[model samples]
Target: MSTEILEQEIALLRQENASLKQQIAASIAELNTTIAKLEQEISEHKQTEVVLKASQAELLAIFNAIQDVILILDFEGRYLKIAPSSAPSLYKPPVELLGKTMHEVLPAAFADYFLDGVHKVLKTRQIEKLEYSLPVGDREIWFEATVAPMSENTVVCVARDISDRQQIEAQLRHQTKDLEQTLQELKRTQAQMLQAEKMSSLGQLVAGVAHEINNPVNFIHGNLSHLEAHIQDLLHIIHLYPQQSLETEISDLDAEIDLEYIKDDLPKILSSMKVGTQRIRQIVLSLRNFSRMDEADFKAVDIHEGIDSTLMILQYRLKEKSERPAIQVVKNYGTLPLIECYPGQLNQVFMNILANAIDVLEQRIESKDAPLPTITISTSLVAEGWVKIAIADNGGGMPEDVQKKVFNPFFTTKPVGKGTGMGMSISYQIVTEKHRGKLECCSIVGEGTEFVIEIPIQQ
Candidate 1:
């Protein structure tokens, strides 16, 4: 019994051992194939990692080459990275900036706003723009900054400065203003020259006529007393004729006297001679006033004298009565310090303004039934260094549009042959440029017009 059991056990063991050997060989083959596949996959993964690292290095190089200032902040708003393109001189390498809070590395004044902008982008995950200024050293730099969000609580900020453009714009504005002022001054000078030319021509004409007329006027004036004396002697001789003619020889006195008409006409002839003499005297006086030879020199002069002389020259015009206007002249002179100026030029200014005032008054009165026309002149010492002269007229005032162009050269509101349109403009130049003073005008439509001139007092 033992032998049979042993033989069966041995055969079973042999069969099981052979089967186990085949299973072990198959398992070993499967394990080897699986390990080879895993090793290949590991090698491929390592190659892909190397390629990715190479691409990242290339990207970093490109980023560093740019000139713009770039900063990278960590999750907590600390400076984690910086590129050379941004803040080349202001910051060092990214390693230096690493692990430092933005505020700590940079001053609080500069970093506060920068960090705030960066955090805002990080929190909102959106691009934020800011424009501000900072003092780089001594000069101010204006910057425009763009903050953008990166991966997971990281932000990138870029900044650029644009101060030169602003400065150029400011200079352009100043040049424009200066050009406009220069143009205005040129116009004023031209107007003044034109006025001076006209006045000089008129003065020459008046002087020539005055000189020519003076001879006849003097001859008539010289003989007037003799004519009166001759009339008295004739009257006396006639009175004695009644007593002496009947007895003594009547030597043709009646024939010499033209007794029929002379008795009545002689008195009228004498009266006419007196009236003519007076008229000639008035004309001579007018000529003198027109010339204004007394105050023609440049010196410290009372403006009132110019005004008075101008008024006297224009007395005939003032006396003229029109159905429309009864022009009245008024002088409201105040104690004024004398001003250094050319008296003849100032007198021309007064004459031009006064004449214009009269014309405007006439127009106003003709247009409607308004108040009586009045031209008023006033003067006063405005301050220690200033003297104010005002000429106001109750005349047809200028409109806004017309007033704007009133000072423009060749602008005229009067009819042709009546005005040259350079009067007020010349006055302005004389008072402002030549005299170193200011001249301004105020007017309201249908109300009145007033011109004010301010000049410095003479030393």
Candidate 2:
């Protein structure tokens, strides 16, 4: 019985040991599976870490590449993170600016402005664009900032220095002003050349006409004296023959021919011819003075002579026409010194002013009983050794606005074909710019217009 019991116990023991070995083997397989799975998860985690590091490095690279003064701040204007920047206009360096409230690092006024901007961004939930200035050390620097919401409580500001752009704009403005001034000078010069050419041509024409008329006048004048002397001799001979000595045929011929009447009329005709010739000679001389063919250069000349000569040249226009009465000229001449000036140019100024005055008078549309069309010219040496010549017309005056722009180029109040707008403009330049003078216009509606020209008497 004891031997059977021992065998059964050994069998039971063997069964238990085999069962335990199988369980242990299962446990080892499960442990190996768990270890393999854990190893795969570790590898995946390492790959994710690598990807995160690459993303972080890329973000940092982009932030630095933008090269703006970037700031991350909370709504209270406290700096949260400051990006490294290469800009030179920062109020404070990145190292010092980080972790600082705006009030602690900036002026109180500017700090308040910045905090308001941040609040505005949060309330509107939109990007804010603004400009500001900061004093670095000695100079103020301009900055442009772009602020955008970064989180519920924070904002990001990207600022750039715009001082260089502003400087370029200012330079452009200065250059434009210089160009405009140069253009005006060029225009004035061109006007002077054109007017000078016209005056020269006119002078040549007048000189030619004067020379032509003078030749015939001289021939006729010289012959009149000789012809008169010969006729007187003949008349003396006839009178000496006596009526008593006349034959019947000669007396009858005298009765038929009226010889006595012819004798009486002949002397009076000769006397009138002499007077006419003298008037012709005087007109020719005036013409010569006016053309000034030999007086083109600057020299001391009688200002009154210039004015009178110009008036003489314009006499035809001043004469009475069938349509209107003659325009009267009243001259109040004051004693003046011989003014040193370009005589021809001064004459041209006179011509322009007088011509304009005549035009105004001729174009009078007033009632027939209106004041007689008169131009009053006054000359005087005002207090500074200056010659003042005022030409005024009692014709229709210009409006205040027209008077203001009267001296501007291409401004005219006449019909296109009758007037070249450059006349008054050139006259102004001749007086003011060339001769260092002042030309002023005074006028009142329905009253009269006067142009006052003041110039130094000496060069």
Number of the predicted model whose lDDT against the real structure is largest: 2
Best by TM-score: 2
lDDT (Cα, tens digit) per residue for candidate 1, span 162-277: 56766887899999999999999997987676956576546644654555456557766766786675577577666776784543433465566555555576576667667667
**Whole-model Cα lDDT per candidate?**
0.73, 0.81
Clashes of each: 5, 0
Error of 2 at 324 (Å): 1.9
In candidate 1, stretches whose alpha carbon ends up further than 4 angstroms from where it belongs are 1-297, 322-326, 365-368
Residue-by-residue lDDT tens digits, candidate 2, 160-243: 888887788889899999989999999787767566646643664365445545655776677677667657655755775766
